[model samples]
Target: MNIKTQLKNFYLLQCGQFVSQLGSKITSYGLILWTYDNSGSVLSIALLTICTLIPSILLSFLAGSISDKWDKKNIMIISDSIAAFFSLIVLILLITNSLKIEYIYIINFILGVVDAFQNPASEVAISLIISKENYIRVSGIRSLSNSCITIFYPILSTTIYAFAGLKLIIFIDLATFIFAVLTLIFLVKIPKRIYNTGDNTNILHQCKIGIKYIVNDKGILSLILFMAFVNLIASIYNCNLQPMILSRNGNNKFQLGIVTATIGIAGVIGSILVTIKKESKKKIPVILNIMMFSFSICNTLLGIGRNYYIWTIAVFLGNVLVPFLTANVEFIMRNKVPLEMQGVVFSARNTLQYISIPIGYLLGGVLADKVFEPNVYKISFLTNIVGSGKGAGIALIYIVIGIIGFLGCCIFKLNNDMRNLDN
Candidate 1:
């Protein structure tokens, strides 16, 4: 296919995927609010997150291997269909007044398993369809879509939850799933990878080959490790943000939604900026480190700021730096990794990066509830620094994690292998 035709087809696929994601995010946000309201425990939230992460992490390698063996479009369609079916089941349970916390955990676990296959398939599919020159720009565009989803989803979901509750929200998700499936089946045609007839490698051997490829490349391996550390620190903020904001704001759903919307707007602005700028061929690591530093500073500000307005600005500023960092990292991987091996390699990379996330989530919750929240009131020294309040302990944790993130960046800067990955 010509470049023009290829770009057209690629974007058509993205449009369908984006619509499905929009619906999914709305339902996700609504469920989060419902879970938090009913449980009122940070640990409960942590458990939900753990259930999601563990399945994906465990299945990532297998999923990646499967993606390489199958048609990417078919894998995605199957994954989305399974997820939608489960969502419908949840909706039925809700309508019957039998929806429980256990059900959400079980459903999230299943979705995570399906996503393990879907994510790598989708990533590899993009590499198949788009030209190398467009990787960075396309990454930015994808980020922009995510930003738009974040921007609108919170506002819409909160409003819906207030009036109609989860039933209507879930129905919307089911419809979007069908739309996405139909689009893939009819509108988008994904090119398949051709394997060598003489090669006949088993899945386990292919998995090892993918691992060896990364291990032999010190630069890429170091970069992945650095990112794993960064993700570990960031996960704490992710798990706790809602609880902190809700605790400080009297558990007001509307206020939490506003903060989320503001952050999403910042993300949209960042994604737009990245899309507009000409792509740089060098100094990617330097630019990524700079963005990470800026992000760290924003997190620090969020921790120290007492006013809601200040918190909003901090959230906005922090999210604004995300797209640039994410796009550059994606560009590196897409450029460095071969198309055929991307499914396994990307899965391996994700497994390494994501392993720490659940650890961070579980620890963040435990530290906040068991250690920090109760003791912050008792510790005179901490109280004097972060100030005394309900959410003060969580705020302090954010500051510590932010500082740790900056330190991780500094370490990355000092690592010659990671810094020279693009070169």
Candidate 2:
């Protein structure tokens, strides 16, 4: 396909994706609020996170292998269809007043499984459709889609939830799924899957080969390991964010929405800048490290500052640095990994990086409830700094995680393999 045709097709795909993501984000925020209000425990939110992540952690390798062998468009359509069906089921249960926390856990687990296939399929599809020269710009556009969802979903869902509640959110999600499915079926023409006759047909063997390919590459391997650590730290902050903000804001949904939206606005701005400027040809590592360091500092400020304005600014600045890091990393992957192996390779990368996420969620909750929240009274010196309150312990956790993340970035900077990856 010509470049213009390819761009047109990709934008269509992105439009469909953006609409679907917005709906999903709305549902997610609604569920988070419902679960927290109903259970009134951070652990409940953490369990929900675990249920959502565990499937992706377990099935990513198999999903990636399948993506390489199958039609990407069909995989996406089928996954979205299945997910939509489940969402509809949940909606029905909610309407009937039969929905429970366990139901939400089950639905999220199933959706995670769907994502195992859908994410790799989408990534590989982009690699196939777009020219290498546009990878950075396209990555920015992808970030913009997510940013738009983040920016709108929280406030929109919060407002809708106040009147229509969970059932309406699920219905909205189902509609978006239908829209995405139709777009894939009609508008997006995914290139045919490339098959290698010489390669083994065994799924296990293909997975092994994929792992070997990633591990044998020093640059990719180091980057993956570093990212795993980053995910761990970030996950901790994410798991506690809702509780922290709600605790500080007296559970005001509007206030929480505003704070979250600040991050999204920053993301939109960052994505626009990256899309316009593209990425630096050289100094990729320097850019990546600086962004990471900046993110850590912002995170630290978020932990230390109790004021709403401080919290919003910290979150905004932290998120603003994210697009640059994401675009650069994506560019590296697209350029370094062979097109044929992108599905499996990207899957493997995701699997490894996300392995720490569940651990982080579980640990964050346990530490917040069992350790930090209780111990704040005992440590007068520490309490003097972070203050004494309901969410203060979680705030302390953020500071520690931010420090660890900064140290990790420093270590990453010293990794010659990662620094030289794009060269």
Candidate 3:
């Protein structure tokens, strides 16, 4: 099949991804709230986030190397099946009334380990379906699909959990995974699963080769660093949004769900915009501006008060910039790397970009409970302008973080090297 046909073929995989991820988003938010409410310890929930990522860091190099060696299609199928089973097992635990914080950690950690394998394989497999020029389109579609889940999962999951239970949510997730698997069986068409052997070497050497590949690419490495800093800010924004809303004590699950899902809804909106936006290398600088300014504005508004409705509006707006930034960033990376080395390059990028996520989780949880919510009750000077709501007092950090993140993005424009690339 041609690349165009492959595009049609793999739409099912994207659909499957959407369903599986939607299930995950719902369960994860529910689990976060459950852990916090039961233990009243945001730190515990944050620790769950930290533990889940540890596996990805440790195993990513090997995962990237293996992605180059294996049948990409089979790898994804196995990964999906295992993850589906993981959700089912969690559902059983919920049914037995044995679910706990430790259980959440275990499940997420396993998913991370599985994802280490899945990410590189999926990236490479998509290339098999599409030619180089069109990978960005496929990726956009995939990102849009991801956004769809984000938009729907929280509201759907929270409402369902409210009426039924977490068990039902997990079951819904399982069903989605099964559907994804079946869809892949019928829709995705990978004609051959062969890797070039003219450059064959030892397995140990393959591992080292992957490592050396990223290490040697200065352009790739620098972009990875830039992303790490940006994502650190992003991670803080993410981990704090729920706690920020829930700080008032009366935050219903639905409110929390909307807060959680708003960014994704924005992403869905952003992805749609990408489809129509005229494609050009120059649009990238505009995207960076959007990232810097929108996030700055979001943090500024978030610090202004404890108004959930207001913050939701801010996040929804920020969502537009984020997906635009993300899609373009992926496009840049796809263009920079060679096919054979894309897995290692991409995984290495992820490893570096994700370095601060754990830190973000730890700091956000601890600070919200210990620092910001406690003594900073009347954070005077600037943020006190709207100091009327429950969380209005400690809004300075939000503005500070947002400003810092925006500045970081701005510096990207000042650098002549990155901007000169497509020229």
For model 3, give the 10-residue run with minimal summed lDDT.
385-394
Question: What would you estimate as the lDDT of candidate 3?
Answer: 0.73
The runs of at least 3 residues in candidate 1 whose Cα sits more than 4 Å from the true structure, single-residue gaps closed, are 194-199
lDDT of 2 by residue, 1-423 (tens): 898998999999999999998988899889988899899888889998899899988999999998888888888989888888888888888878898898999989989999999999898899889999888888899998888888999898888898889888988998898888898899998788564212557777778878998999989998888778878987888899889888877778888888888889999998998888845876457455755766587778878888678888888878887888888778788888888778778888999999999999999999998998889789888777777778898888888888878877877788888888867
Model 3 Cα shift for residue 89 (angstroms): 2.8
Per-candidate TM-scores read 0.96, 0.97, 0.92
What is the C-alpha lDDT profile of model 1 across 166-280, one tens digit per residue? 8999999999998999999999988866431125777787777778889998888987887788778777888888899888878788887888898789889989988998766
Candidate 1 versus truth, CA RMSD in Å, comes to: 1.6
Q: Enumerate residue pairs that collide in model 1.
A: none
RMSD to the true structure for each prediction, in A, is 1.6, 1.5, 2.3
Worst 10-residue lDDT window for candidate 2 reads 193-202
For residues 80-133, could you state the per-residue lDDT of candidate 3 as single tens digits? 888888888887887888887788888889988988898888887776667776
The number of clashing residue pairs in model 1 is 0
In model 2, how large is the Cα lDDT of residue 327?
84
Question: Model 3: runs farther than 4 Å from truth?
Answer: 196-199, 378-394
Residue pairs of candidate 2 with colliding backbone atoms: none
